[model samples]
Target: MENNSKKIIHKGISASSGKFYGKCLKILSGEHLILQIHISEDEVHHEIEKFENTIYLTKQELESTIQKFSKELKKELVEILSSQILMLEDPIFLQNVKERIQKKLENAPLAVHNTIEEIAERLSSLGDGYLSERAVDIRDIGERIEANLVGKRSDYTFLENLKEEVILVAHVLTPSQIIHLDKNKVKAIATDTGGKTGHMAILAKNYNIPAVVGLIDITEKISEDEYIFIDADEGIIIQNPSLNEIKLFGASSKTDFGDSKFKPKKIAETRDGTRILVKANLESESDCDLALKYGADGIGLYRSESLFLEHPSNNPTEDEQFHAYKKIVEGMKNKPVIIRTFDLGADKFENEKEENPFLGKRGIRYCLQNKNWFKKQLRAILRASVYGELSLMLPMVTSIQEIIETKELLKESKDLLKSANVPYKRVKIGIMVETPAVAISPDVFTKECDFFSIGTNDLLQYTVAVDRNNSVISDLYNPYHISFFRLLVNTIQIAKKQNIPVGICGEIASDTNFTILLIGLGLREFSVSLPLVPKVKKIIQVIEISQAKKLAKEIMKLSEEEKYLEIESYLFNKHLLNNLV
Candidate 1:
């Protein structure tokens, strides 16, 4: 029953950037659900044995492959799968499922499926939008098992049939799916659902996949083998694209994307030949190597949250934290690495098991309460500082008092290390001006801190009162708001007045269109995703800092809409002239 369906095109979020042309190789898709079926105690034991055996076999078989790719792109892929395997022994998870299944009297798979159904129903029942969204995590674990059973391993070469270059269309993608994809054969990816922070998007960005996500019902409308054009710049996916549209897109793609060297090669430079600093934002130590390989001037934001993510404990030890930070610093050598202290809290790290964890325990509030955690990280950074170029950046600080307190903590950690006969180095401490209070009161912070890094991602969310993860208020999370510019201007002026440096490490700095706007706002240092350095650097190379400053002043006076429109017009005009000379 081989029915040839006409090729259809669907739209999704373009997490990665590049043109991919290939035959459709779609995988089965399903909604997120954690189901636990009824199973006898005996059956549960047998299934557990089977799961262990399967993991053992998989590990033995994949050991050589994992070792071969260690520290490379495949390293993270292997680590993620290994963590999933560890879940089989997770006492709480296994025991909870066992009890639920015993009451239902079903097999392991059925019991898991039933529990998923129950959890899904409960989530649906919850009227609290904040709590209801966490059901996705439950479903993710189940998906991992299903993926393992279905033989869709993410080793890149698994899909032998997908050898020709083409775009991948899917309902949704898991981390493994994106990790295992063969970029040589696959040109781009478009998924029907996934947030900007989802693993699929993150994986795509890491691998340089031309991805588009957050496209609703795109899979249902688009057919297999359809001629589709994904315009990532405009967030548009065109099905049955006209020849003219393809040509126009093709031209744009040629300029911005094409071939194996998809990322921009030019470094950010000033028209007068001054080199503007370009650094990469890092989530984990593994990402540090990638940043250096991409020619980042240094690291602007080394997010410390990754240290806490995979662990069961509330905080990682100072020794453990020190090793990770040390590795990143050692990897970067002479490059300046700005490490942002643990910044999780808010809605970003929601655990269903922990009631009201966001408002209850997170960020500095959580650390201040758990001084052991705070001191460990501070001590580790101090120790790592002696080994390489290091600077500390505090996250979510609302007042000068917070900055002062954090500085005292650093001094205390340094003193403790000094007393212990452990080597330590004097490191510059900085604060992230994210909240309105901090942005407005930058002068007070400048007096206490070594530098200021404006985290526009959180700033935009707080300014608009938008839960960026929520679809309802997502539109309001505009980075181009004139009010945002005013905040930047204020932060910059205050920092400059105190003879300190200011850098932007938000998504805005990475955007080529707004590179000039950032420079014009008096931001001399820019930090972005690793892959974006060359493009941002190229933009820096073309624009004169003085001209950018003039444009920034003009934009600040315009209406928010007009301000954004003017910036676009300016970039477009530059684009026409190929003025990035």
Candidate 2:
């Protein structure tokens, strides 16, 4: 294609939104071609020298520009560019590619591109999108190397003076690229490649942009400056849209999607006066904003696993852990945040070894065995609570004694914090009702712990003796089982009898049907994903608690074989109102 005839309309996940018109700077596929090396040993040595020189130049150029941005951006840019450069200099990869090219007697650029393409295709076929994207990065590196091998330099350019009212399209997007997008200027984003979990998908969600992904070869169909319409609801992209479609989508798109400024009302009373507590699950400090925006009554479950995942190691220092906790609490101010301690069991931790990890070392069991690691997490929670309303919970507690011992450990850590002159709030402690042992013995656990949070996900798995992670038996692990709901209600019933609060911070809480069931079952507090709160809250507002309770009673009496489909149809047919954000 001639440069004059080249048109620019790359499809991508719209990280930011708007509509505008600009001239094209089409980035063709062959620009950064990496050649395969098939020369003699002396030539191979010389090629390595060239690769080193190119890497050094790229590093120096990046370093000189580092100070122009904030620390996070600088760090990310360095990490991304550095990784690409390092891959080029990897002796193993370089040697392997060189040998393959020599054996094939092919053009170096063609050979390298083919190998990268082949590997990418294989990974893509494996069915994991995350793993497939890694292949794209490899191909990108090869392109950069190919450019160098042919005496070409990287001509990557940033889009400047972007139109303020333009819809951006691309094949895909990255977290780093999304961060740089001017959200105020862009209208919507559409991509040819991505899924709901991809970084671009998450960013588009947070930015309140209309985004559609996984459309094949859409870049070729879209024309530069052509009026287009994006409907995120149906995952539809209409190029040169008809006037009727534009009017409909434009009206829907105008609704406010950003985080609400006010904290979510804890008193989630419907117009008819049914009350429910809308709590939020915390994954990290970053999740706090989403929680507050959604008007969460409090933080229900804080997964400490994300902190460890962010760092390069399995364990973070107590102080570092405290800082992460403190950030979330400080964000909430006086609102309560329930922090769950290190949940790393043999299965969750990459470095750890355990036989039948789920049944082996997980939750409270793992904490007890790794006393020092457990204490550090407890100490961090204690220190952070000094700043705001805070509470702690132990996950995967199977026995009454485990809860008792964990409570004792909490006391020990609290005493240490007190001795150090840290002013702290009196924290309410709880245990996750996960295994059937605790569910059946709720009377014992309720008496020992301050509160309970039914971890429905794991409880369902344990109830059916099915591994939730195993796809083969996924159908068997049903949360809707009459017995499962019975256990949950029984546990909540125990908490109510004991006058100790029981909250649900599981995926089930987010489902509208289950929300009603829980309310009817005498469970008053619910902690759900931030995005689902409005809909759940709205449902609570309209639902009659007595009706739900009556339905729960009916469900409890039905046999397992008769309940699943009956309940599904009943709920689906009810036209149960849901507030989707």
Task: Compose the digit string of candidate 1's lDDT tens values, residues 1-581.
Answer: 31133323444544554443334555546442324444556776676554445435544544554565455554455665565555555766666556654565565555555555576568758754323333544455555544453345533345535646677777776654555566667667777766544566556766766677778777776668765676553345665443423332331332242244444444656877666789887755766657877789889998788667534464677788999999999989888999988877644444423555433455666666657668889999989998789999888787676767777787888789889999988899888888888887788777788988888877877776776444334446666577777888899988998998899887566666567767877788998766667767766765677777766666676645555555555544544333332
What C-alpha lDDT does candidate 1 achieve relative to the native structure? 0.66
In angstroms, the error of model 2 at 57 is 26
**Model 2 lDDT per residue over 1-581, tens place:** 11222222333332222222222222223345343445654455455455456555555554444444334343334455556656756777666655655565444565566766776788788876666656655655666556655767544334224555666666655543454566665656666676544455555656555566777676667766655656453355654433322332222322221344533355688555756788887654755665776688878887787677545465689989989899999988689889887777787667788778888888788899877788888888877877888988889888877877877887888788789987666777888888898898788877778889988878888888898545344457666676787798789877888898898876576555566667878888988756566657766765676667666665666635565656664444344323210
Question: Best by TM-score, which number?
Answer: 1
TM-score for all predictions?
Answer: 0.63, 0.60
Task: Write down the TM-score for model 2.
Answer: 0.60
**lDDT of model 1 at residue 417?**
87
Q: Tell how far residue 320 is off in model 1, in angstroms.
A: 1.5
